[model samples]
Target: MKNWLRTTLVTLFGFSLLSGLLAGCSRDHHADWSADDVAKVRDRIAGKMDLDAAQTQKLDALIAQLQVLRSDIKGTSNDPRAGFATLITGDTFDRNGAQKLLDEKTSALQQDGPQVITALADFYDSLNPDQQRKLRQKLERHKSWFGH
Candidate 1:
């Protein structure tokens, strides 16, 4: 009985550790994007691109539009991991429920993603060829920073 108890306790401890690690891994670090965060992003991009007054204004407008769309989408979105805890805790596996959650996320993306892409495309088209080259080079350098 003592050996059985010890084995059960060890198994429980292992399960607890696994669940904790899974929960931590599932967290979204960039889930919340506030206006202040958007401003910081704009400033960083502007600094890298050396945007003039007109480009700065356009970029600022694009950032504002994106922030508004993000807010709208976030307001209507559910917790992405709502049912994940149950799965981690050894509850009945609901594959359909998990698929539904993914579908909801995809639908949300489809709703707002097109507008963002269009805005970014417009901004990119507005850049001069030299500015475009500089931006491309800067992006390539960032790939190296990520160990790519």
Candidate 2:
């Protein structure tokens, strides 16, 4: 009886945790967006990267392409499993589905990976070595000041 009770409690706890996580990632948290949405994200990224008007326009274009690629890879929230889990999950509990989804998300993340890296490289390259060092110090100081 004790063992059965313990197992039942564990199952209930796991179910509750899964439900909470799923609820957290529902429609309100989805990243579905149009080209205009990418423009806004691009604008925010531009501000973060200290980009000028021309650079912002270019970044917006790149973001639009990345958004399309991302959508294809991530799929709709309804089937948020990279387009294959729904099939596999029909027969089993789909424990492997989580790992598969994570792998796909990681792979999809690489879609815009190089461009973002190149953009950051270009920004740093444009700055003098002294400025780079100063920027690092400023960031560290800010982090320290915030008790982070």
Q: Which candidate comes out best when scored by TM-score? A: 1
Model 2 lDDT per residue over 1-148, tens place: 6999999999989977976665545333436566577567667756666666665555655655555565756555555433443534575667676677767767776766676666656555665566567668768878852443
Give the Cα error of residue 71 in candidate 1, in Å. 4.6
What digit string (tens of lDDT, one per residue) describes model 1 on residues 56-82? Answer: 887876776676566554555356455
C-alpha lDDT score of every prediction, in listed order: 0.73, 0.62
Clashing pairs in 1: none
Report the CA-based lDDT of candidate 1 relative to the real structure. 0.73
Q: Model 1 — TM-score against the truth?
A: 0.62
TM-score each candidate: 0.62, 0.51
